[model samples]
Target: MKAIIAGTTMPVLELTLDAGERIIAEGGDVSWLTPGFDIQTSTAFGSGGRGGFMSGLKRMVGGGQLFLTQYTAQAPGSFVAFAAQLPGTIRELAIDPQDQFMVQSGAYMASTPDVEVSVGLQKKLGAGIFGGAGVVFQKLAGNGTAWVQLAGEIVEYDLQAGQSLLIHPGHLALYRAEMPLEFASIKGIKNKFFGDSLFLAQLHGPGHVWLQSMTPAKLAAAIEPYLPEKSSSDNN
Candidate 1:
């Protein structure tokens, strides 16, 4: 199979598969492919598979399943498939890269044992102040290794064992869940005043750490202009 990501921001992924090759995607994430394809979301995802009246009504009538078919078959056996599960759902598509097949997610993370990631603050933050920002720290508990993926460019800092690196919350995607985290004060008053550079989560590492280039803030900034305007009354 051969795959190519075509178009600019909001790119389309084209996959060419040989005979007997298949590609699968979770229900809602089908947008990663073409515009039109059948997406079968399950109840486990709160898609109304076994929810209350309002939930089922919301899902079934509000576009029962998202179906689209603008895909051009690059090769035979290049079929797309979907599945529903009660417990574990394979929302990610894993394909063999050697066969020209490519599987990509909007954003995802992977971690190994001996790594721990936790919220930096002892108390929950108010949205008014944090603005969707939350500090997380990554650390190595025992001797082990792990890796994480971010959406955009990642700036990595090298620290010797027991040394730690502080990073902005927007720059973080996922880290080892076991790492201990706490809200620590900024060093200098000047750094704290800058806002952007203030109150970072400290990641202590005997393990590896990764960050993404694209962040929710960056994404919202890029697309906000294109979003439909809301009426002043709607704000009420």
Candidate 2:
């Protein structure tokens, strides 16, 4: 199979498959496909063929679909495409037993059949206690290629052993699964007095980390004040 990533700011992933080649993605993520392609939707496979129903359930809990869609090429030169939902970049990760990734929920797009998407983290201590929000991350493991969509500009950092970075929870996009991740409250009395963010994500690594500059929540908050307000007559 050959893959091509097209466009900028809102990229699309196009895969050209040889006869008998198969790819898997979450249900409804396909943008388009060629004719004569065999499509199968099931709960028992895709995402690495792990535990069937239980695997599907875990994916759903991590903000993914319970059903997975597999596209097979019946003839030569068949193709399928997946488009990014937001104005950002689509990145491809090499998944294997040694190299795996933990991606924020809703980041997964598609992957080879051997890749597995499972729940990584359901909640963080600081986020659960201070923020009242449960954060979810999806683990991409197994041996294959996987695609993830990140919002806005992406920055990559390679951390040596014992190196750490503090990140806002929303900006945390994808990182090596081996990296240690946790949430911690921000220090300094000035920040507390000024009502700054209470908690930040701490990631320690001997691996790479990817951070996105924009998130859906930040975008919504930015434009919310400009939106027209509702009136009493509108309510009626």
lDDT against the true structure, each candidate: 0.36, 0.86
Among all candidates shown, the one with the greatest lDDT = 2
List where candidate 1 sits over 4 angstroms from the true fold: 1-26, 32-40, 43-76, 79-106, 109-123, 129-149, 157-160, 187-197, 218-236
TM-score of 1: 0.44
Task: Report the C-alpha lDDT of model 1 over 52-157, residue by residue, as the tens digit.
Answer: 3444343233223222112333446454322211111122122121111101112312112112222122233335323533332322122222222235444544
Summed over model 2, clashes come to 0
Q: What are the models' TM-scores? A: 0.44, 0.89
Model 2 per-residue lDDT at 74: 97
Ten residues in a row with the worst lDDT in model 2?
A: 124-133
lDDT per residue (tens digit) for residues 139-207 in model 2: 999989999999999999999998999987789999999999988777562344225546678999789
